[model samples]
Target: MDVDYELIRTREVRSQKKINFPDKVQRNVSFEHRAHGESVEWHYEENEGVAVISNDRLSDERYVHIKRANVMDDGVNIRPPNDLIEDLSRPIYKGMTTVYLAHEDMLEGDIRSVYLLTESQAFTLIGERTDDSKELREVLSNTPRFLPIPE
Candidate 1:
C-alpha cells in the first residue's frame, strides 16, 4: 500500500525550562508543542539514528525508541544533515505531562531517516555527546525560528 504522507507541520524543538537531575539519570531535552496532531509521524535523516520518545512526565521509566530513517513501507521521509540531526537531539528539562523524543546516531553507521508520532510533547537526543547541552541551546535559540502559529 502507498501512503501519501503530507507535511502537516514542522517545529524546531527548543527547551522552555531547565531540569536538575543527577548524573546517573538520563535527562533528555524539552520543547513545547506549537502544533498538535493525533497520528503525526516525525521524519529525519541521519546515519542509523535512534529516536527515544518517553512519557516520563506521566510515568517514570517509560519511553519509545524509533530509528529515524528515510525508507519505509510508506514513502515519506526527509533528508536532514548530520549537523542538523545532532542539533535537534539536545537535552531539555521541563514538566508538562509531555512526550519526550531523543535520538543518537554513530559517526560510522548506516544513513537512514525515519519518523514517529505521539499524543503529547516530547524531548529528543542525537549523537553521543553529553557535554553539548550548552551548544545545542545556542543553536536552537539562534537559527531556524519556530513554525508559525497555525490559524
Candidate 2:
C-alpha cells in the first residue's frame, strides 16, 4: 500500500505547537546540540521562544549566543522562519539528525535525514526513501509510531 499525505517543504511548514506560561516565572528549557567540534546552545524562552526555533537552524549567520529575556506573560506561537522558506538549500543538518525536534519539512529535502522528537525520546527516519515501491511498502508496514501531520 502506498502512503498518501501532504508533504510541505521545510520553508513552507508551519507548526501548530504553541508555548503558554506565566510571565512572572522564568521558565528555561535548555538543550545542547554538540557535534563535529561545534557546540550549539539552544534555549526556549517566553516571547523569544518561537523566534529562537525558527531562526536558529534556518539562519545563514548562526547565532553565537541567543539572548534570554524575561518579559510580560504572553503566548508564543511557533512557525518556520521566513529565511528558511526563501532558501530551501540551507544546511540544517548533514548526514545525521540533530537533537532538535524534527520539522516535517525535513522529509522533503534530498537527504531525508528526518528526526522526530517525541515526548520521551527522539526517532530518526533516515534512508527511508527508495525508488522501489515494494521495498518502500515493506518498510512502512513495519514502522512503529509514525503518523502524518494534519494540515
Candidate 3:
C-alpha cells in the first residue's frame, strides 16, 4: 500500500544554559510529520554563542552535524563536506543509506548523487552557505514518516 505523508505540526523550545555558557541560550525547533500508519519527529538545535547547529531524529537516536555556508560569487555551489561524509560513514555497513540534503540552489542540476534512505533510517547533510528554500520544501514534501528525524 502507498502511504501519504504530511507535516502535522511544529514546535519551538528554548532553554537557558547552566554550565559552561551560562549566558548563552539553546533553541530546539521540532517538526512532526505523519503518514497513514506512522509518524516521525525531527528537530534541530541552535546555539549561536558556541556555534553549535545540529539535527536529530527522536525515533532512532541518530544525529548529524549541520555545516552552513553562504552563497559564493560564482553561484550557489553545494557539496557535502568530506569530513561529514567520513563521520557519517564511519559505521558503514551493508544496506546503509546516505541522503544528501542540499539547498534549493544546489538542487537544480547541481546534485552529484542521490541515495535512498530506507523506511527505518536516514541522515541529513545541510549546506550552510546557501539558501535552503527549495531543499526545505522538498524535504517536507518527500520525506517519509519512517525516516529518523535529525536531532
Candidate 4:
C-alpha cells in the first residue's frame, strides 16, 4: 500500500514560561509552548527534546496522548537515540521544493514512515519537533548551510 506523507511545517508562535514545580521536587528544565489554537498547545522540554500536544477541547474519547522526541544529533556523525532510525526512515521533507500532504489520521503514534527531506525541510521539521528549542537552534545556527542535492 502506498502511503501519503504530509510535510509538517510548524506555524505556531513559541514563548518561554516559568513553571512552578511541586515544592519538594527538584528539577532543572525549561518550559515552552507553541499555541495551536484556543484549546490545543504544543509543549516541549528544551533539554530533552521531547514534545507533546495538549488539547483541552478534544471531543474524541479514543484519542491517545503521544510524546515524540525529535532527532537530537542531526544524523551527522550521530544517529537517532534508540531505534528511531528504523521507525522513521523517511525524512519529512525531500529536496528543496518538495512537499507532501496527508490527513491527520493518516499519521500517528510510534510508527515507521517514509519520506525524504531536503536540508531546509529537515531544518523546518527539526524546529517543529523541538518546539524551536534553544540548544538545537544554536547548534543549527552554528552549522553551515548547504544547498539541497538536485533530484
What TM-score goes with each of the models? 0.18, 0.21, 0.23, 0.20
Ranking by lDDT: 2, 4, 1, 3
For candidate 1, report its TM-score.
0.18
lDDT of each: 0.25, 0.28, 0.25, 0.27
Q: Where is model 1 more than 4 Å wrong at Cα? A: 16-47, 52-151
Q: Which sequence of candidate numbers ranks them by TM-score, best first?
A: 3, 2, 4, 1
Tens-place lDDT per residue, model 1, 1-151, is 1112111123332243321221111122112224521112223223223232221121112222223222211222122234333534432223322222222321112222122212121222221222345554343233222111122
Candidate 4 per-residue lDDT, tens place, 67-145, comes to 3322212211111222322233232221223222122232342221212233345555545434344544444444333
Task: Return the TM-score for candidate 3, rounded to 2 decimals.
Answer: 0.23
Poorest stretch of ten by lDDT in candidate 2: 22-31
Q: Best candidate per TM-score, number?
A: 3
Clashing pairs in 2: none
lDDT (Cα, 0-100) at 55 in candidate 3: 23
Candidate 3: RMSD to truth: 17.6
lDDT winner among the candidates?
2
- How does residue 34 of candidate 1 score in lDDT? 41
Report the Cα RMSD per candidate.
18.0, 15.5, 17.6, 17.1
C-alpha displacement of 147 in model 2, angstroms?
A: 24
